[model samples]
Target: MKNILKTVIGIIIIVGIVAIFGLKNKESQDKKDISPNTSSSPSTLTVINNQIQVKNFEGSDFENITEKSIQVNQGSLVKTSSTGRGILESDNETTTIIDKNSEIRVAQSEQNKTKIELESGNLWSRVKKVFGQGEYYQIETNNAVATVRGTNFGTFFSDKQTIFMVSEGDVLAISINPETKKQIGPESTIGAGQKVIIKDGQDPIIEPLTESDKKLEWYVFNQTKTTPTATPRPSPTVSINPTPTEKPSPSPTSSPEPTPTPPEIISVIPKTINVTQGPVNFFVNGQKLKRVTGLFLNDILIKFFTIDEQTIGGTATSELQTGTYDVSVTLFTGEKLTLPEALVINNE
Candidate 1:
């Protein structure tokens, strides 16, 4: 009997130890799985108004209009609005409007994609097209995806439904059906001057932009200045003089000393270098050079270039006067890296 009791006690002790060790191992694994891996690449934000404030959670730098450019970290908030304008321009020219009282996260940005997650409040975006197809900018709330294109769109997230209004282009609003776990159909194309609302359980409703809903007046602000009218000038009367009476008898001395030959003006011939990346763009003098993929020397990708293993042979050269120049190469991977300056043929 004593032996049996001792054996039972020993078994119970072993089981308890094994159970505790197993539980500890499971807890350790769970902790490892739950911790998220942090990213190093810094995000960027542009403040359009004085009302906005950007906080860099990772200690990465951020820029304002005063600074001109800022490097933002993973978590940041930018404020902006009508009285104060804050515009964030990405490497790809995707502009985000940080409206008043908005909290947004610099979610993720890479060579091919950029995502700005709106935690709360309102935001307006004019996302430029990246290289390939798919959603470029997404505004998500409790249950909606406002897939934005290279257009002007406004998004509002409150305790209620996520509201999207398309001021100048198209946007696809998608929502998930909680019970089915399947994505519902996107609301009909919200064309320019349209608005769409995504509620918790109902389908998206599309409507026209009313006076109260018009947030951005793109055409009004972007219209070109009108040409000024010119006043006609009165013509003045002119008198014709008779030819001077052969006063040059002694003239002709030396046939006017044969006119000195003028120096030759060298005509510069510009060479066009073809640069092919996934897609190519050129900038010169801090301004965007249009249609530069296959063109003349004046078109230089001054600040950016997209290069890959396939772009090894591709080169960009300018027929510029020999002097120190500031040249930068921006890879499509969102890397605005500067290259060592190369000397051109000196004209001097």
Candidate 2:
């Protein structure tokens, strides 16, 4: 009888322990369900160059906002200057350059999300793309909406119109009527070097901007890292057909075989490379990555940009600093294209 009772007690204890664990799991899931809308951290803004002022719409407060930390989504600023530059830096490494002569209004800001209204002037932004995240960073204007991500781009509002252009990647520029809050059709997916113009009471125009027309300066990042590999070519389909009639045989001479052509490169990254420090693999994506030389950065000649065509990569010669730079490469045939930055220094 005692043995039977002991067995029954053991079973009851196991059941009790499982019941307690199930209740704890239920409580944990409840907290997770409430976290998204309720828990978001703050973001900040820093002044990089020149002077900038922020005017709070709440109770008509105003202050000259300069080189310091500023909060997001607090209040709106009604005015802007004719010339000044500032950077809105987030914790996620997303940087927004509040360009010179830009009149903007802040709507709301939180962790991994931001919304603003550019009433006039110009502003540039770069936001990293996070897959599977239900969030966006948007810049609005009286004439259009520029949603920024996966690219470096800028928006300009002046002369009764708004223009958004892509510098390194792609950006979505949509036209909206601010007065009616209605969208104007055939939304443009603006790619690198492309732009869209939104004017009042008209259809949006999407086209490539001229070199002289692109005025906003942008800082490009990770140009070498983002590349989608190409798909393999399909094999030629074999078809069965009736054998042709044989022709009369003639005395044949030895003929030379044609030389095979080299494979062509379609698209590649590391087009704008950054070597933080030490030896790193110089990655390239394309068929036969040969002849990747004649490179320049920030108008300075870079010998390290030279590559071993067979291996398609090389080691760096030295260290570098933190700053913006432009790169270019010259072809053997004298054609020139933008290239990667490189720095060379003696360890000794």
Specify the highest-lDDT model's number.
Answer: 2
Worst 10 residues of 2 by lDDT: 216-225
- How does model 1 fare in lDDT? 0.50
Q: For residues 1-348, what per-residue lDDT tens digits would candidate 1 score against the true structure?
A: 999999999999999999999999997784453222353345454432243556555334543334434665444545443333344556655656556566677655444455676777777776557445753666666656777656667888777577788766688887656456367775567887788887776678888888766524432221112223454444444444467754423322222233332211111111121222211222222112221232222335322221211111122323344444333434334434333342233333
TM-score on alpha carbons, each prediction: 0.46, 0.50
Q: Ten-residue segment with the worst summed lDDT in candidate 1?
A: 262-271
Please state every model's RMSD to the true fold in angstroms: 21.0, 19.1
Model 2, residue 188: distance off in Å is 1.9
Which residue segments of model 1 deviate by more than 4 Å?
A: 1-43, 57-68, 75-85, 177-187, 215-348
Which ranges in model 2 have alpha carbons more than 4 Å from their true place? 1-41, 57-59, 78-80, 131-133, 214-348
Residue by residue across 1-348, what tens digits does model 2's lDDT show?
A: 999999999999999999999998897774443232444444465443234677654334657764344764334563445434555655555666676677676564556666677877777776666524767788888878877666677787887698887777777777888788688886678888788888986677889978665532332221222334454444545444456965555434444444444433332323333444333223222333356555454565544332223122223324544454444444566655543333232233
